[model samples]
Target: MSAATLAAADSATMLRRYLLRMRRYPSLTVLLVGMPVLLLLLFVHVFGGTLGAGLPGGALPGADGRGRYLDFVTPALVVAAAIGAAQGTAISVAMDRTTGIVARFRTMAISPVSVLAGHVLGSVVQSVLAMGVLLVAAVALGYRPGAGFAGWVALAGFLVLLSLALTWLCLALGLLSDSVETASNLPMPLLLLPFLGSGFVPVESMPAGLRWFAAHQPATPVIETVRGLLDGRADAGTAATAVAWCAVLALAGWAWSLRLFRRTTTG
Candidate 1:
């Protein structure tokens, strides 16, 4: 077989292994999937109406405060769910490293890239699945986005890119850690980023320093772009910016992860 074919085969095998392991556990995935749904429920039913009422008039067209709030918050929760899934990546990667699976792979004929690719693929898959469950729960809760077919396509593309970027970052963090606990904790800040961004509220609603930070952070542009797309007000510049951020992050994380993986497996 050609080199490309061999790599593909190895990656597929690794991917199946990762998926089967996840299926056996189920609990971690359940927690990863459920947290976002619970948060969505709490935010929409419990706090959404009040928060929506507090928004300036005309925040969203043709919708009441609660409805508008749901529209705004759903994407954030989706992103949050994706990030939450990264915690699983970090933990899984750390477990593999600590348990000597990675070392064993190094002594075998398996493709090196496949080792990382499998985990990254699994993480992204799980994240997307979690996002889907979150979306279903959101729709059941009366969260109606204004996006049409093309818009939904754009949203899916955006989500996939974001998941890839975040998953890689988590993997790198996992590889960098000395323990599974450390790896799991390293990505905890990601969960807090949505709150800091324009996720739950508009950037303008924050204090001056916070508002500036909120507007410029990676999450803001992505969230804004998602919000615009869903609300039928897509902006090309914002979309480009979001893509740029995801690309840069994915590249950085991929490079960092390779370095750490090599260091750990060979040393």
Candidate 2:
């Protein structure tokens, strides 16, 4: 068989393996898919309700209502939905690596390339499900899209891209980690940056210096870009900035994950 034919066969085989694994543990599906929706409810029903309306302006230039915590929280929820899965995916994937499942899979027709990507495919699916649940919950909680249908579509696309980028990063981390625990913990610092961004609170509300950093952070641009799309008022700068952030992270994470995978596999 030619190398191309062999490669195609390997990919198909790997995808089958992935589906079988997913079927065996449906709750992994629940955990990956349900957690984001739960967080959205927690924030909107509880925190957003009180805090959103209480904000100084009642609503800012981009958001629907500073008072409508649902609107305020939904944009952040999108980001949270994207990033939240990274930690869980990392820990789970790391366990697969440490236990020699990855090695075993590597020896099969499945290539190392397929092994890592298979895990990321799962994450991408989970992210989309989480987003759907969150979207319904947000709307139910009185979160209306001020931007309209096109805006909603853009927002959805952004979340998907963000999820892809993050899933790859987590995969890399999972590969490089000393253990599953480290893989899980490594993403927290990056995760927290979103909070400082326009997610839960406006960057302007944050302390001046911290605001500067927060405003410039990856999450900041993502949140802004997402919020703008959701509200139908996305700024070009914010959208461009968010796209740039995703690009940088995606490239870095993909290269690093591959390198780490090689080192781990060889060593």
Candidate 3:
């Protein structure tokens, strides 16, 4: 087989291995997927009304108070789900390192790239599944949008890009950790990013310093683009910015993760 073919086969095998691990430990799966769902319920039912009523001018232009809030909140929950899965990715990678899985794989005929690719792919798959759960919960909680077929497609495309970038970054962080505990803690701040951005409320609602930071951060454009798409008010400028952020993140994460994987295996 050619080099590319061999790598492909090995990656598939490793992907299956990670998937099996997920299946064997259903509790971890539930916890990872359920946390965001619970957050969605709490935010929409408990806090949506007050928060929506407090929006700068009023509720979203065409939406009722709680209804408009849910539209804004659902996309953020998707982002939170992706960030939360980063913790899982870190733990799984760190565990494999500590338990000598890395060494074992090195001693085998597996392609080195396959090792990292497998974990990245598995985590992305898990992130997508978790997003599905959150979206379903959002719908059940009365979340509705005006997006048509193209808008829905765009939403899913952006989400997959976001998940892939975040998962790769987590994988790199996991490879850098000496222990699973440290790995678990390293990615915690990613979970809080949505709150700091234009997730739950408008960036303008924030204080001056925070507003500046929130408006400039990576999550804001993505969240705003998602909100706009769903509201049938998608702006080309914001969409371009969101795509640029994802591209930069994905490239940076991939480079860093590849280097870390090489260092971890060879050093």
Per-residue C-alpha lDDT of model 1 across residues 146-195, encoded as one tens digit per residue:
89999999999999999999999999999998899999899999998899
TM-score of 3: 0.95
Deviation in angstroms for 151 in model 2?
2.8
Write one digit per residue (lDDT tens) for candidate 2, span 1-267: 877676666666665665677679777667766776787767755666557766656653223443377777787877887787766678778888879887786676545676777777777777777777777877876677887888877777888788888988888887778798898888878678778877887777888999999877788888888888888999998798888888888888899988988887787
Which pairs of residues collide in model 2? Answer: 53-67, 59-66, 147-231, 147-232
| Residue 110 lDDT (model 1) | 76
Could you estimate the TM-score for every candidate? 0.96, 0.89, 0.95
Per-residue lDDT, model 1, residue 123, is 91
lDDT of each: 0.89, 0.76, 0.87
Highest lDDT: which candidate? 1
- Measured with C-alpha atoms, the lDDT of residue 126 in candidate 2 is 73
Q: Which stretches of candidate 2 lie over 4 Å from their true place?
A: 1-9, 59-67
Error of 1 at 139 (Å): 0.7
Cα RMSD to the true fold for all candidates = 2.2, 3.2, 2.1
Regions more than 4 Å wrong, model 3: 57-64
Clashes of each: 0, 4, 0
Residue-level lDDT tens digits of model 3 in 120-229:
88988899899888888888878777899999898889888988888888988899899999999999888878999999988988899999999899988988887887
Give the better candidate number (2 or 3) by TM-score: 3
